[model samples]
Target: MAFSSDLDQITRAASGDRQAVSALVNRYSPGVLALATRMLADRAEAEDVTQEAFIRAWKALPTWEPRAKFSTWLHRVALNLCYDRLRKRRDSTMAELPERVDMALRPDDALDQSERVQAVEGAIAALPERQAAALTLCALQDHSQAEAAAIMEISVEALESLLARARRTLRTVLMERSEA
Candidate 1:
């Protein structure tokens, strides 16, 4: 995912090279899917968003300029798509929150681990959208601070602020859950 490799792949893919396309997809799809899943909190909707993001990527390739890293651009596209879906859901009269699932693990250790993961994820899903995106990109997805800020179209300071708030919120929520 280096700058040069992305440029090379984008050039080849833009020329309709199937191998290049596959390589790009294999490299980037997981990150895209993970981001969408975290943001949407629905596997099916996340999958749809992932597919649509790639489709948009394919369409944009021909006219793509290297103003930003390909991954950054792709992620930005996916984030915007998530925003659109979120807005639509907010506007819809029938939208309802998804129910939480209980995982019944046999071992106490495994159950504790699963509950911790679920608690963190649920807390994240409940965060403000920008905060969630900031945390997901910088912490979970391991994007560089500059790259993440670029993706979110915000300043590094703003991103740091969002990350701090997100961490504080997650800490408070998870602590309450653990105490309960």
Candidate 2:
């Protein structure tokens, strides 16, 4: 969607325009769902997080500034919701490490490729929160460093550092997994 159209829709939505709100939801839900699904690794929980993110966006629409892309700000909202869920899981009495999913691919595809992908995803989920967020925004979602930094509420330098550490950690974790 074009920026002008987005700006107009957001502006209208903030003023209680139902159609504008629906348009915005349709435009952004997939991205939000992708982010949440990647972060949470559970489709049901990710769907809940995505819905909560949209509800939060509706509440915050009136105060939203158009200085940044609506998608960027929406990502911030979605990610924050992911963080909230992750935090709750961490604090739970029965909290345990995230489980691995056995990826089933086509019969013609290589099993090694599926194993590598699963290992990488498991490594990502094992990362420290900030490192995971940095990698998710910069590597997975293709957000520029500057845009990611703004969404993460960190300096560009800090974001880059997090990315570097995340990459290093992922490599180490994956290597260990392979050796085991």
Candidate 3:
């Protein structure tokens, strides 16, 4: 009956149906890409991580359980890939600069905005992996705390603690940036 239920699509994907795989990719790729980009802070790396995440999902589909939502499983996979890359990288300067704005802007204003953005990004990059992941999922992605906690494989209370710590760290970092 599992194959006849809400997971019929995933059942097909598990059995190596290209159409099911394609459908799943289309439905979830954007979210995976966003999570990877936000977590890694590197669009190119994020794209690679996204691709790898889907490939892994495809491989693991045979063993996939229906308990967790597919999206949550995929996010966890993507976060793990992002963390792997984060671990292997050594140089602090390796983090990508803030994305360039396409809008035409005054010279001084652009400079100011760019600096502020970079400072914020740098602060985020400096956070502990778990805390940063918690904040990224809950705050930026608009995921419910319950959902984010599930994705991070932590209790909701722990997620709240991480969020508080990450916020305090971000505040201190930004304030220091402004003062300097």
Candidate 4:
């Protein structure tokens, strides 16, 4: 059967179709990994989150209602898993600090572009969790404000506020780093 009929596959999986469940995982795994990587900021941790998300999605499949898009539901699940991991690591002791050095921006070459991207990613990673989440959902993921709000379980106005704050914070952080 074509997996494009995702709703049917979901129904079959709900009725205990193991292959259908596998198809669901196969279909959504890449998107889950991308989202996890952006949120977790560590490749290994993102991998773990992606695996855990699929496991949770499979286990929760029976109870999943068809109210929202399946991808949207999966995104929410992955995001929540990332949040849980962040909470668990909140109080961990830090290793010795590395000396801060102002790195020059060299965006001409591909390597320099990659480094610049990584620096920007690091800045985003340092943002407050809610701000990062909001930016990820609305800006990076290209979701509309209303859709992002629905995924975040907040009102559209609240989502817009979060997006505004995230953008302002990112601009300030980037500008400060550039001036350094």
Best by lDDT: 1
Q: Write the per-residue lDDT of candidate 4 for residues 1-180, one digit (tens) a residue.
A: 332487888888889889988888788888778767767678899899888877777777788777887777777888889888777777574522212224444454344665676776676666777777888887787667776777777898888888799888877776676678
Over 4 Å off, model 3: 1-6, 15-19, 91-118
My TM-score estimates for the predictions, one after another, are 0.89, 0.82, 0.77, 0.80
- Clash totals for all candidate models: 0, 0, 0, 0
Cα RMSD for predicted model 4:
3.7
Estimate, for each residue in 4-111, the C-alpha lDDT of model 3 and write its tens digit. 442777888888788887888887899889888777777899999999998998887888787787888889999999888887774555755345333323234445
Model 2 spans > 4 angstroms off: 15-19, 100-115
Q: Report how far off residue 28 is in candidate 4 (Å).
A: 2.4
Q: Which 10 residues in a row give candidate 1 its minimum summed lDDT? A: 100-109
**Candidate ordering by lDDT (highest first):** 1, 2, 3, 4
TM-score of 2: 0.82
Models ranked on TM-score? 1, 2, 4, 3
What is residue 167's positional error in candidate 2, in angstroms? 0.8
Which digits, one per residue and each the tens of the lDDT, describe model 1 over residues 30-68? 999999999888889999999999999999899989998
Candidate 4 TM-score, C-alpha based:
0.80
Top of the candidates by TM-score? 1
- What is the Cα-based TM-score of model 1? 0.89
For model 1, what is the alpha-carbon lDDT of residue 59? 93
